[model samples]
Target: MTAIDWADYATGDKNAASRTLLMREFLRRAALWVDHLGGSERWPFFDIAERVDSSVRADPDLLERLDEFTNANVPEFIARRMCRAAVHWAELRESTEVTLPDLPDPYEPLIVLYERGGVFFVENGVADFEMRRVPLRTWQANLAPEPVVEIDQAVLDAANEEVH
Candidate 1:
């Protein structure tokens, strides 16, 4: 499980501690949803994006906090992508004509969560390295060795004698 210092995101905004807590809870739920849906690669981001939009719309204060965090922590391009994704998700949900934008890559806790779960996010749906060309057998051959058990010789002899 990922441990977050809520204060880091809040940035000394003690007045909105409750909002910060709410955001933290929402993120925890979102992380759980990601795990349930098979990590970042297979994550149904459209659904989550819509939720993010709705949550933000419901609480302007939360939006303020989120914007602050995003500006401070997220890269400009990635923050723009996130905003676009929220708009795209809203369009899809409302059945508006879709203008397909580049999907937003996971950031922060999400990146760490998915990585820990053994799923990596590739930008533009393309891996930088030629992982596909590597043969399965070759990959298997490079796997770590299996575990070995150590048994005392005297214990083994005692067991054998008792069996006899």
Candidate 2:
């Protein structure tokens, strides 16, 4: 006979546990937003999204399980509440302009952020990310000559090359 295991209940078994998990995820995304980016002067929201995306890319299953988890555990009220809260926290949540940083314009979702950098990116609907050519400054020393840290425009031109 198989041994009994009540770990599911203790760990997370019922509707309550599911809602908690969903809310947590929603909250996490909310926190990434500029509006919810903590009630103070914060850096661009998209900048934070970039880091978040890179980290999340590791566990790709999270997105796949999201629907099953949400529908089974998360109620319409929870989803609505979260969406409403997100909108209330930041108008962009409601507006179509919401996006992540590095993507100057509003975008569909983070999936796009991973794709063509041209696509606009969204993060909790508060901020937007746009693609821009930034100089890859050298971390050589505290103070170096101008050429040592010169702004190279060729980087943008080479983005399409994808090879040396």
Candidate 3:
């Protein structure tokens, strides 16, 4: 039997919690990168690396731009790489009779607390008719919430502009 090297198989961590925390940090960094890129109207994470890399190669003065672009697109690139590394690590660990700990996430209830508008906002709380005393007998006097499909960041931005 070949001697198993636990250190070689492990991805710098054997604790499932540490692995999860690392993944969460990666995703958080990715989100921040996307948000920063969005500020410059650079979004959708398509060919960002190539665009920035080629641009920087043509003009070295745009190194900062290249840095920001890579930082913004790190999530898309790093996630796949990390996943492959984790899988390879797990396979190696499994072969050495190392039992993987159960990563039980008992925070299902907490999900509602961290819910965002687009994903977790429930429409059930919205009423078909206005709750106010104003009566609408005609077709034009009706009040209803806009369809979800038509509501987006642009709509929100327009509403916010009026507030300021």
Local accuracy of candidate 3 as per-residue lDDT tens digits, 21-132:
2223322333333333343242221222232232222233444454454344433343223323333333433343433333221121112111111011113422111121
Alpha carbon RMSD to native, model 2: 18.5
- Model 1 lDDT tens row, 67-116: 66655544434333444444444444455333323322223333332222
**Going through the candidates in order, what is the number of backbone clashes in each?**
0, 17, 0
Q: What is the TM-score of each candidate against the true structure?
A: 0.28, 0.22, 0.23
Query: Model 1 off-target regions past 4 Å?
Result: 1-16, 41-78, 96-164
lDDT of each: 0.34, 0.28, 0.27
Model 2: per-residue lDDT, tens digit, 55-164? 32212353345444444543333332232222233333333444534322122222222122211222443222222212211112112211111112343224334422
For residue 117, what is the lDDT in candidate 1? 22
- What value does the lDDT take at residue 158 in candidate 3? 48
What lDDT, from 0 to 1, does candidate 2 have? 0.28
Quality of model 1 by C-alpha lDDT: 0.34
Q: Decide which is better by TM-score, 2 or 3.
A: 3
Residue 162, candidate 2: alpha-carbon lDDT: 40
lDDT of the structure predicted as candidate 3: 0.27
Candidate of highest TM-score: 1
Q: What's the CA RMSD for each of the models?
A: 18.0, 18.5, 22.6
Q: Can you list the residue pairs that collide in candidate 1?
A: none
